[model samples]
Target: MKKSLLIGATALALTLASPFSQAHRVWIKPSTTSVSGDSEWITFDVAVANGIFHPDHFAYPAERLSVVSPSGNPVDIQNQQKLRYRSVFDVELTESGTYKVFNASQSLVAFWKDEDGERHFWPGRGKTGTVEEFYQAVPQDADDLNVMETANRLETYVTLGAPTADNNKLTGKGLELKALTHPNDAYTGEPIDFQFFMSGDKAQGTKVIVVKDGEKYRDTAGGVEVTADKEGKISLQFDEPGMYWLEAEYEDDKAKAPAKKRRASYVLVFEVLPL
Candidate 1:
């Protein structure tokens, strides 16, 4: 019975990661962070870039996209248009409270031949839904057959007006960013605090990369590095108002079965209004 469950889990992981290759990194950025009226339309650009959210890279389709209202109802995005670099869509903000624009993806798997010319593929898990239970379904001592590396990426947006707890809830899946400073309500000078959680626990030592608008690489100017503390928290303070992309990466090469090495990431793109 146990062996059957492990095989089932592995199959599920492969199913989830079958969409894209290993180089895809997904992110979504909204036109505005906050709106004043009860009824307003906001646009978003969703993309999967190879250089870690850079605009120069090609983008994949924005799949399984939805907007969750403050009251917890999911709204479908309408009038989505795909561009060369990103996919753009708009959502009508009917409620006055905060609305979350969330885009999550299945895990992606990649394999490489080892020294003995044997192909290995790591297992993958679903991003938004129950990932822990899936991992627990598989045993640790399983064979390292077809070992591959798996990764998951997620993006979220917050429109501030009404009160909502949707932005801070943790899915307890792969790497996730919980905004402590309220991403929609961020300002230019105030430090934005974010907590990283991996597989339900605090993801300590995760390296966070922040890139301001127009930068192509992570280590360029207007880019900064921050590492998660022991409690899995990182803080960022924007020097001026503009668009910014923040990404956190975590890798565990010694991870047990179901994953050869768990390489995961979380990305959040938001605008900081000038003070």
Candidate 2:
């Protein structure tokens, strides 16, 4: 017996669609962006929801979460649980610096038709499969064969005593965010700069979409869009103090064989404080 498939038809449909246009948003919300104490604890909520910060759809898998300490060390999370609509966890910050909480993943998705002319998908319809499994199960001459590689990251920042840049360094493997302005130091009415990277290089002309919390109460979605400059940087300012969601996506033809394209997406939830 094989394991169940990681993706279903609906999930495959969403994967083929525009990455940024998806209605379901995935995020990790921290109790506080800044804190102080010898040992402070921060609670987090992880969810895939239709509304910002609202966990109405499904809980993001808690097992996929991780925390990086200010010194670039792996920190452990406590009290993790998955409920009906959200996953909750707590992190104990013993170091007096910033922490990076995130969920990052990469996978290959494929579509094809078998000899019988029946449509099929790599990883199949009912169970998960690996690259080797995909190669063995999918015929080399399969009709309409299409394959894509995807990398996605969802992240939030929390500072215990002071912010540190050690843990914010980019891995240079996929799409990533480099904080020119410390994420925990964002303030209302003041501009904060951030740089985007794709496979370690500057992601010039990347489009970044931002939406503040409380979209359910507003008449309009009130989302804002900004494009990265030639330096792969964008500056943002908020009028009111609140939590905001920021996302960026990039697609290219850098994928290896069996995969024609690569799609990378990055998401961050940060707070803006009143001056």
Candidate 3:
């Protein structure tokens, strides 16, 4: 009877945890996508949840939020707020070009036991390392072992003046989605193309999730999946004007070995304007 109860509880835990875990994506949303006047202040909110713009989940801490100016420098924000639903921060639009708001967190610890009774520990952060480097850090006596690392990296951009295709400013290490079409200048009914890169190389076989922000406060998207071509490209078309979030995930199956799995996630938030 005790064994049966234990198994039942475990099943219940997995059932409840699956949806929550799958939805825990981090994203940032600015108050406006493009600014033209003398307005120098922009307010934004940041959150970590399945629903990108929805405030149903937890907000990212202030320390995790940051801004990069148009002149290639980090800028400070004010009116900082944090709540269960979402965290809010305000930035002064000092420059006239495109401004970037970003948040990156450290890798946490994740562990699981496989059918073979082997335990695996991986960093809960976003993509961080090569497959060999990942397993090399694991202890050989990893029978009840732990070997892995996962990290979360998120970014969003706002145009201060005329929109430009300045993709080079957003380039960096790890998994990134480069907008082939100028993000802020996109219009409804137009396809927004993005290129995916893992560790600076076109990452093929990556899975992307695209969802339109809804009014009711839910993370339900039925999830749209798209595959990257040989050159690591994927796109989505907006039928109407509204906000949207895109998330890409890639797993190193060949590197998992006898272990469970190693994967990375990247997220982007953009808006579509009406024609």
Candidate 4:
């Protein structure tokens, strides 16, 4: 979907009430984030006032939310907020760019699982949303007046996290979520569709486990195992969608240097929305 379209939809979701739309509230999972150095722009969080707006209407709920820029240009996102479970966004923040959050609509989102004993993306589980950016432009000085040059220069961004007035905050560092995906949204009597990404450490073979909606079911049979590619990317698909908690535990012993050692972990929350 187009960024403008997503922005419009986001506006309507928070500003109005409708049968098709769910209520939401704004809160930041991580109160703050950092960047490398002076760049262009930065990205962080802005609190919303909605209850909790999840694409499924219940699970993975993130209330009415939308992002806008200083130029009055509504920003585009991962096209997945509606499908918070299976979507991700690269929020930009730098000198070249500007970051200001509108607000959130509702409450803390919770995770859910499907019936096939698989875990999916969970909301309100305290996940780390990526804020990528650097500074892009220099502020104008009264002594040096150059409007044309300023307009011509491109906006830049850098990574950073800020807080909204609401004070609803979620923050930490490193990868917050373990690799996991939803097997099904509702329930699945047949094969389900599952997919996820993991970032912990380098172990021989990673074990994927799932906890069904508050239930304990271990499908370690042909056990859902995953292997990293050359670029450290792994994905799996399920036949259905359900509330589940996907986790991975690995250790990197080959690292003799501090930089090579593993320290942080991350889990991506997202679900497949009806396209």
Candidate 5:
């Protein structure tokens, strides 16, 4: 998927070597600027290498956090508590765009204790690393800032559209499964609904089929035309559930002559977990 990948870079003035006489500065890790799509997890690791909490510290520190839009409006944020660390909020981007994640102290740093038994003070609130998604507008989640001459690091973006009320949708060039339901994940009894729909701009005659655990059926998805309204739709049952693979077939455009032209199909892996 050729989703726009906006590259942005941020710099910090607080040096790692400096000593904190007081709650010094806030920092984010993996300073690599570009985050990998899969390996992309942001962690707000606080510095506790020194400064133990003293009794005289002010009320527990406030780590007020929120996502700041490109235009500078504060979006609604939600609190998140994960096993590793508790985050004040998370901003999820659905459409690709530019945005910024803003974080600050709710109050001056002090002392605190999380679900974990460890009682912390000073930069105590720093350990809460999990930030739940707030706004979701992607490929729009941009820190979109700079122009890089050459970016050695690349984030592979996957076009995963949310399942519509009908359950299935296609990303034109690829298969998208958001609202599919599998009643028989084990493939034991009567088949159930694993419905979905898709379409493309190119008028490529494509075919979609449902294949069972180990069997094959010719009754492929019948009316998946590349036309405007009559795009591809999947609404069928399976004999039994185990792991049914939805295979899409199209005349292989990449196949050269002389050599037997192979059919090109995209296999959307699906499963029906037993209830």
Candidate 6:
């Protein structure tokens, strides 16, 4: 689907009274993270839902998704479709290494009160605007102006044969995950270490949350929360083998003019196999 159309659909979903439309989480799940053979295909489901891995809220924009092959080249996606609650796509893993599937975006948002005490939003709410546009349109003397820059990344990994580090290198922008343990090689009951970075620097004291799939079916939330140490690293272990969602957020005063604060968030869906 086109980017404009997807934004309109998302706005429509948010207009509804349902709770699912409020504060939903974005995730991309792969059919399998690790596969063997000369060539293979991996199907992915992208959604913004209340529950992890559940497509109950709305379909995430398929146009925003991208794939990077192990050779550090852009890979093409196939059969992209936006369904009622989720977006689906296929990736042909012809390369014998890991492929990174992700949806990453950064935008500037602002709210200000005019001299007449009327509130206004830059580019309007639920819409994305560039930093240059924000400075050009917003009034310099605007009252109570609150400007923020947000960077969000939702990603997963699929390894064709042997896992490769080429696809996991940090881009030195926004919030990112650096895996001390390869995502595709994680096993149940084993501690897997991951680190968080904000604008290429180690994001110390960041809070990371992990939620296993099937959250709605369980009585208790059973979610795990860990804090990144001084080194911006956290270790996680899962008792059961299943798909898990990991999310982290960091806020800082590194934003440029017109934006006082910058918020960065990341989400990763990874699979753990039975040991």
| Tens-digit lDDT track of model 1 for 1-275 | 99667665554444334322234445787777788765888888787565544644444456566678887888878888888887888888887677777655534344445556644444433433234644543333444433334446556676647546565688777788877877777788898888898877899998887777665543556578999998999888887787887877787775555446766767778778897
Of 2 and 5, the candidate ranking higher by TM-score: 2
The lDDT values for all models are 0.67, 0.82, 0.65, 0.28, 0.28, 0.83
Per-residue lDDT tens digits of candidate 6, residues 1-275? 69677556545533221112246788899988999999999999998887887899787777788899999889998999999999899999998999999877667766689988976656653456787787688887789988877777788999999898888889877789999999999999899999999889999977888899889899998889999998899999888998999888788798897789987788899999897
RMSD (Å) per prediction: 7.3, 3.5, 6.1, 21.5, 22.5, 4.4
How would you encode candidate 5's per-residue C-alpha lDDT over 1-275 as one tens digit per residue? 23222110001111111112223222211111222242233232222121111112122111433444334455454333322221223344342222333232111122234455433322121221111211121111223211111000001111112211221223443222323342212234444433222223332344544444333233442322221113334455444434443434333334222212222223333443344
**Candidate 2 on 46-93: residue-level lDDT in tens?**
887888878897777777788999888899889999999999999999
**Scored by Cα lDDT, where does model 4 land?**
0.28
Q: Give me the candidate number with maximum lDDT.
A: 6
TM-scores for all candidates: the values are: 0.74, 0.88, 0.76, 0.25, 0.25, 0.88
Report the lDDT of model 2 for residue 262.
79
Which regions of candidate 6 deviate over 4 angstroms?
1-22, 113-119, 124-128
In model 1, where do residues sit more than 4 Å from their true spots?
Answer: 1-25, 50-54, 106-110, 114-151, 160-163, 216-219, 253-258
**Candidate 1's TM-score:** 0.74
lDDT of 1 at 49: 62
Worst 10-residue stretch by lDDT in candidate 4? 147-156
> lDDT: which is higher, 1 or 5?
1
List where candidate 2 sits over 4 angstroms from the true fold. 1-21, 113-120, 124-131
Of the two candidates 2 and 3, the one with more favorable lDDT, higher being better, is 2
Identify the superior model by TM-score, candidate 3 or candidate 6: 6
* Worst 10-residue lDDT window, candidate 2: 1-10
Superposing every Cα of model 2 onto the true structure, what RMSD results?
3.5
